[model samples]
Target: MKKTLICGALLVFVQQMNLVQAQDWKPVEGKIMTEWTEKVTPENAHQEYPRPQMTRDNWVNLNGLWDYAIQAKGAAAPSNFEGEILVPFAVESALSGVGKTVGKDQELWYNTEFASPKKSIKDHVILHFGASDWETEVFVNGVSVGIHRGGYDPFEFDITSALKSGKSQVLQVRVWDPSDDGPQPRGKQVNNPSGIWYTPVTGIWQTVWMETVPSSYIAGIRNASDLESKQILVTPQVTAAQAGQQVKVSAWKDGNMLAEQTIDPNGTAKLTIANAEFWEPGNPVLYDLKVELISGKKVLDEVGSYAAIREIKMAPDAEGIQRMMLNGKFLFQYGPLDQGWWPDGLYTAPSEEALVFDIQKTQDMGFNMIRKHVKVEPARWYYACDKMGMLVWQDMPSGDMGNGWEMKVGVLGSQTDRARTPESEAIYRTEWKEIMDDFYSFPSIVVWVPFNEAWGQFKTKEITEWTENHDPSRLVNSASGGNFEMEGTKITGDIIDLHNYPDAKMPDPGIFGKENIIVLGEFGGLGLPVDGHVWQQKDNWGYQSFKNEEELLNRYAGLMKRLEELISDGLSAAVYTQTTDVEVETNGLMTYDRKVIKMKAAQLKPLHDKLYQVSVK
Candidate 1:
């Protein structure tokens, strides 16, 4: 009896151990990151300066750990919270410490506290969220400050009214994410993970913090570049103390102001950068801008910003095919489809090192561009892209219903998109506009992809024209791969786009004698899951799984070599299938945990470099 009882106890202990082990992050069978992720704490997660483009030396980072609780959709904030979960990592992510999931029927509560900035009264405290997934409500000191609906864009609320002077300020965030169940433009996240359906991200999945700016500040300013004219048009949206606000602009390089000028309210400020230091995949130079918001000579606020002077266009190749060119010179763009997810932080990186590492790795491999595929990262990520000399192709996340007939055809739907109801279009347009206005300042983004493979794509011709007219300097790809229709005019876009996979091949642009600029938008997903990095056991998968590392490398090399041949056949830019494995999708050069580099540089860099060197002439 004693022996039997001892065996039962051992069995129970083994089962308990298995339960705990299951909670630990492991690399998927076909993905890479068995080792890149590290344990995070309330004190030391994502401590980097979150906002890179607009930097003020005196801002506080509210990242690290926060209390979290899952409750019913309409339930009030929980009186008591569940244990601590890492901030900026979504509840659904393993890095979040909770590894919990919430849907439309549920809401997530986040609670935290911090001391106010010095003399925060004179310095108005602005509570900022790098981003919140789906719908969000914010409370300061238990008073509701504001609520936002978009999942990907950043939002801020003036929380000074809700704070107690000099005492530690408390913040509470409530979130509801529908994932694929609603029409909020969530990319890849699905309740039931499957092929291309990634794990869901709920609640605050980005940097959360507070900034103390004066009551009257440069609320926001937009600077757009004209590659053709070597100038950047500046539009400052200032919140001056009184009427008749004016802004003073000064240009600088390496810390010295080159020029200064003043512009009245609602007027355009043109800073003509002579022989502009252009931004391209090879060389990205940003000019420092200091703009002072003034009312009757009283300097209400001064904000520092920067913009690059560069242009991306398509011109006819020697073979009569059009090729992508930057600054009127033949330039080849090669990139990975940067998914922008981390094992410990999900939507947010564990630390600034993690953020810089991805860019560094991409640069080390010698690729000059990254396609921010179907997701908008925190401003810091794009700043890294700019600082690290990586060009960007930003895609608006794909959304809208999949019930359309064109869905079966697998691209953007057509004019008669009998599928698009009135309600679906409303949410899609509102969020798309916010996304455009939020990150418009970054100089690295040369192309704005309004749609991807036709997801919720409607009014393509109209939207493309508006996008081009709104920011005429950058190139635009109207439809990437599906519902492929151009705006019946030569002036609509600068490049012709096509999608390729497993084997690298482009579509045939028929003999219209039109200048066809070809680009292989996506290709190559050779997955090899390392032993220690994976999200889950049953769900993770890749487009093409390989038996071993050597096989994966050989296949990748073979695919890239074919990409080079396509470049000679008019391919100007090529985007690989992924940056890293996420959730159930194991097709990444690096594993999800980011510990392993699946393909060696000696084997892959030569091929990528060859793509950049392929002559369009």
Candidate 2:
């Protein structure tokens, strides 16, 4: 009894010491932080399951404090680490606990230790990264596992072969990002961030986790739901399949199973529902899905997923003007241009609640759609949109700027495409395809925007056509207020979008409305910076600066009133300047820290309601 008491006391002492060590970490000071910042700690930093579309019950979140080091671009891994930086947050972000920059000439390295999660010889361990910047290489127990190049897409490595027979395993990551120094699709990152540009995010900026699966498992799932046919095509990508292996898919609603089908491991399962509930704004209905891999009578792997039945297309109204249609009806889509940046986390939100806060606030303001401007978000962001019934227009992050913009309305072939080198073109194509393929399963994504304002705009006709052909289910907006390539009577893509500031406007309905859907891609950048909730104290900016909330709301009301008129004039959709203030750009519906909503949702929803009432004829 005395020995048992002594062991219990020692266990409590070690627990207290671990608590003290975790408390030693702190966020870098001197920056505007959100309410969720305080909730973030080394022990709990985005501990939610990273992937929602394809999920398994058993997995481990690798988010927390990790040893970090910055060395020269070509230098070897450092023998000594600088300090403990929070995982999943970029090194330059305040939430990282190391607000230091890793430029083009330097490489950032991360080291961590995790216990081996192997249960048997047939188990294969996979390390998954939600996203990493530019270039990244992973090492398991000092063994090079894999190298991946792409800043926005998720990648994984099978580390089963690299594991050793031990309880603890070492994991190391090396990352190098040439932000603006290279010709990659870096969005708005610049070496000298000023004006519209913001800080650079290097290293991992998303969740890192691991899971053990059977040697042959379901690698991915693709759902193509057709509202017209009342059928959903389920395609499961299996990593390793034997001759007699088969896959089973079942769709459920509430607690009842609706449909089930089994097909060859390599085939697509087509399940038809007698009466399907359509997914749309204000009433997003998602059906649960269960996929199982089986060989004869034994089940190999099973995963939980979900799908929504919806469709978006363009059709002419009574006046022969093209209008964007959702679920066979015309609905004027309106939302903010969400940049997906956080004051504390930069590319990564402080927490999952913080990530969903922006979307909730936007929806509160009566917005139905969001133009996810240049930067892509973590998968959970889209998952929230799917659950909350918010439509998304995703953009390919722009890079290789300084390619002149000289397009004019009512002119054909007014601007020439930027002449990018072979290397630059290849990088853009590879990443864009990966982004589309990786994000194709989300039902909320209705439009795919390939270029924005002629920034790195090249081969407009070819790129737009490829995007449309690749994903015929989603409409293609060739360029949002960028150069237009007129082929015959219409623009290259389905939408002819225009971007005007401080006021609501649209592409000439008389000119482009008949051939394509006309939209005010961006407008009403009314800026009102709250006193204590800004990234910087001085020199804040907006397309149209406002003195106070009353002035901003009054001006915004005027813009909405005009937007209502344009809806009747063949305007199918519109996107406001932004959902939140980013860095020095003060033209947001909410302040940067999200502490203050510049204009209350109660006031904005009524004005937005009037826009939806306007006829599209």
Candidate 3:
């Protein structure tokens, strides 16, 4: 009888261990956190579908606790984990529950177990990662699946063959990020962060998930909208082509079919919507898309998608000066320079709601545009802008700061091109192409700012021309606030941009007005620090500091009052200092914790509307 009791006790212990592993986890307390941090638990952390552009109803989110270990480079995966670190948050971030830094000589390892999705031999299981910093390799059930190199773009691996014959399967990943030590596009991340630079993000900093698909399925789709043509150019990519297979694309509005077309996988079909309403800033209209892979009337696979019809261009106005036109109308674009960094999550936002808050508040302030500075945000951020009718100017994150910088006030000056190694150039080219392709479908992104203030600027004429050829639909600002490379008084790209601090200013239209659209790329870094919301107690900095909200607003109003004169001269768009305070930079309109809005939305909206009214006749 005693032996029987002992056996039962052992069985109970095993059950309790399983229960402990499955319990929901909470975010570790950080030095400074957002309000959303309180709501972040394992069960509800980043629960929303990561990919809003091309989505499938059937998928699993792997964004909770995972066994993590830090080891020397080239070391084998550890058999025992050091501790539990939250997925989708970098190890150095506070929300990860593991505030540790993995240097260039170390590798960050992650291990997790998930159930195999019900599938047949003809079906495949695809493991998807929203993003992982630097170099990453994945393994399923101890079998090496694939490896991805870029840190900013999404990638996936088909692990159908590596699945084990059980309910649970083992998955492992290894990541290495050299940050600024390497020539890769590390953005503002550095080993030791201060000033404009911040902490390094080494490992997975985005959603991890999996989905099941047929052997022959829809691989991807691209949306190109032409407002003048009243049509959407959709091209679908198929995984495995079959005999008599065709790609069918349908556009729906409020459940009513507006247009449909079936074309070959390699062909682009124009889905025409009769009398299509243009997608504008206030009325952001979106059409639902349904794509199907069909084989002789049999639907092999299907996916849900969305699209926005809008056009961005530049043309000569009545005064013969180049002006930015949205659907052939002059609209002055203005907003904060969005750095896209979070104090709690570092590279990642604490949650989707938190991600939307910044965009929504920008719109509420009556600004029509946002300049997404250096760092790239998750796809959902652009999707939010699309829904809210906020225009975006996306910047390619800068790296390789070893180049020489030559600033020109207004004239075309000598360019100091960085002679990057072949490997470094290849890395930049590959990542830039991927970023453009991944974000091409988002109609909100009207401008692509390839370089910011000459940070790692190189191959000026060649890069600008290449970008124009790659995406002719949108105007390219080759280098915003970059070193001006002039060819007989003519600039290379579409716009001539300038950067001035603490107040409003613009590039001299007399030199650049006839050829390129002139813009104020950055200005008005008015700062106000609130107690208990700062990243640090001392050493906070900004271009101009204020003692209270009234003083800050009065200073901002003065800058706006000066900006009207520049607009009359020929400024097309302008970007303010930033959206929120970051690290030691207290120039943000809001505090780092996002707890206080120094300038009220109601007060700023009218002031912003007056700037838009000063357009050239």
Candidate 4:
């Protein structure tokens, strides 16, 4: 009895000491922070399930504080770390607790310890990284596991073989991101952030997790719904499938099974729904999915998923003008150019609630679509949009800027595609494809934008055609206000987009509306910088600066009035300047910290409603 009591006391003491150590960490000071910043702690940084689309009960979130070190580029991993940083937040961010820059000449290293999750010999442990900037290498138990290159796509490594027989296992990560020094697709990261560009984010900026699975498990899930046939096509990528193994997919609605189909593990299963509900703005209907890997009479692995039925295309209206169609009907898509940056967490949001807050606020303003400008967001962001019924126009993060661009008002520019080295071209291709494949399952994504404003606009014809052919389900906006490549009568892609500031403008309906969908890609950048909610106090500027909210609203209403006329002429869609202020750009519906909505949703929603009512013809 005495020994047991002493053991219990010692365990309690150790746990108390651990709690004290965790409490020692705090967010770095001297920056604008969101409301969710206070909710972030080492114990609960991002405890939500990282991947919601394909969910399994057996997994562990590897967030919270981890030992971090900054060393010179190409240097070996350090034996000891400098300090603790909050996981999933970049080192350059205030939420990281060690807000410091890791430049192109340096590398960031992370170290953590987790208990082994394997219960049997047949179990394979997978180390998953939601995303890491640039190049990342992993080591498990001091053994090199794998290396992944890409700033936005998720990657995993099977570390089962590297694990030793122990209760605690060591995990280490090394990351190198050449923000602007290299030709990688880094979006707006710059060594010297000023004006429109923002700070560089290095190291892990997304969730890190681990899961144990059977030898043969479902590695990936690809879902697409056919509105015409009322069928849901499910393709399960099974890893190490045995001969005779099969996949069973079942679609359910409101806890009731709608349809089920069993097929070979390698093939696609088409489950036909009797009464299909289409997914659209204000009427988002998602059907639950259950996938099981079966071998004979035994079930190997099962996962929970979801799908939505929707279609996006372009069709000519009665006036012979191409109009964007949603679910076989013309709907003018309007939203803001969302940068997906946070004042507290540069790339990652302070918390999941904070991540969804921006989307919710945008929706409250009566916007149906969001042009995810340049930077890609975490998977949960898209999942939230899917649930909230928000349309997404995803853009490939631009890199290798300084390409010559000749801006023309209503005609094609004389400048051809940018001449990029083979290395730069390969990097762009590899990452773009991975990004598309990673986010293909999300039904919220309606458009794929390859280039924006001629930033790194290379191989326009080839890249746009590849993107269109790769995913025929979503419409491809080859270039959003970028250099256009003419092919006979029409532009290279489906949409001919134009970008104008302060005032709404559209492509000439008489010139290109007959061949492609015309859109105002960006406008209405009226700046209103709230004093306490800004990243910096001085030199903040917008395309059109407004001293007060009333003036901003008046200007915005005028732009909307003109936009309604354009929609009547042939404009299919439009994206406002932005959802939130970013860095030095003060033009946003909300401030940088998101504490103040510059214009109330109630006031903006009524004005935005009038745009939707305008006819597309």
Q: Could you tally the backbone clashes for each prediction?
A: 19, 0, 0, 0
Q: For candidate 3, write residues 1-617 as lDDT tens digits.
A: 99999989998996787567646455556478999887776666687888888898879999988999999999998899998888899999888888899988999999999987988889999999999998999999889899899889999999998998987999999999888898999889999988878889989999999999998998788998878788988888899888789989999999999999999877787889987988879989989899998888898899988887888888877777899999888888998999988888988999999999999889999889999998889899999999999999999989987766555544333468888888988999999999999998999999998887777888888888888898898888988876766787578889988887877877677767878998888988888878899888888888889999999999999988888887888889999998999988888888887989989899999999998899587
Candidate ordering by TM-score (highest first): 4, 2, 3, 1
Global CA lDDT computed for model 1: 0.74
Q: Model 4: per-residue lDDT, tens digit, 1-617? A: 99999999998998897798789888889989899998898888888888888999999999988999999999888998899999999999999999999988999999999988955789899999999998999999899999998998999999999999878899999999999999999999999999889999998999999999999999999999999998888999999999999999999999999999999999898988987889999999999999999988899999999998899999999999999999999999999999999989999999988999999999999999999999999899999999999999999999988778676654455477788999999999999999999999999999999999889889899999999989999999988886888976699989998888778877678989889999889888889888988888899988888889998898888988998899999999999998999988999899988988998999999999998888554
Q: Enumerate residue pairs that collide in model 4.
A: none
Model 3 TM: 0.96
TM agreement with the true structure for every prediction: 0.87, 0.97, 0.96, 0.98
Show model 4 residue runs off by greater than 4 Å: 1-10, 409-414
Question: Where does candidate 2 have its weakest 10-residue lDDT segment?
Answer: 405-414
lDDT of 4: 0.91
Tally clashes: model 3. 0
Which of candidates 2 and 3 is the stronger one according to TM-score?
2
- Residue 392: error of model 1 in Å? 0.9
lDDT of 2 by residue, 1-617 (tens): 99999999998997897688689889899999999888899999999999999999889999998999999998887778998899999999999999999999999999999988956889899999999998999999999999998899999999999999988899999999999998889998887887678999999999999999998999999988988789878899999888889999999999899999999988998888778989999899999999999998899999988998999999999999999999999999999999988989999999989999999989999999999999999999999999999999999999887676564653322567889999999999999999999999999999999999888999999999999989999999998886888866699999988888878877677878889999888888889988999889998888989899999998899898898889988899999998989999898899989999999999999999898888654
lDDT (10s digit) by residue, model 1, range 94-130 = 6666777787798899887887667544768788888
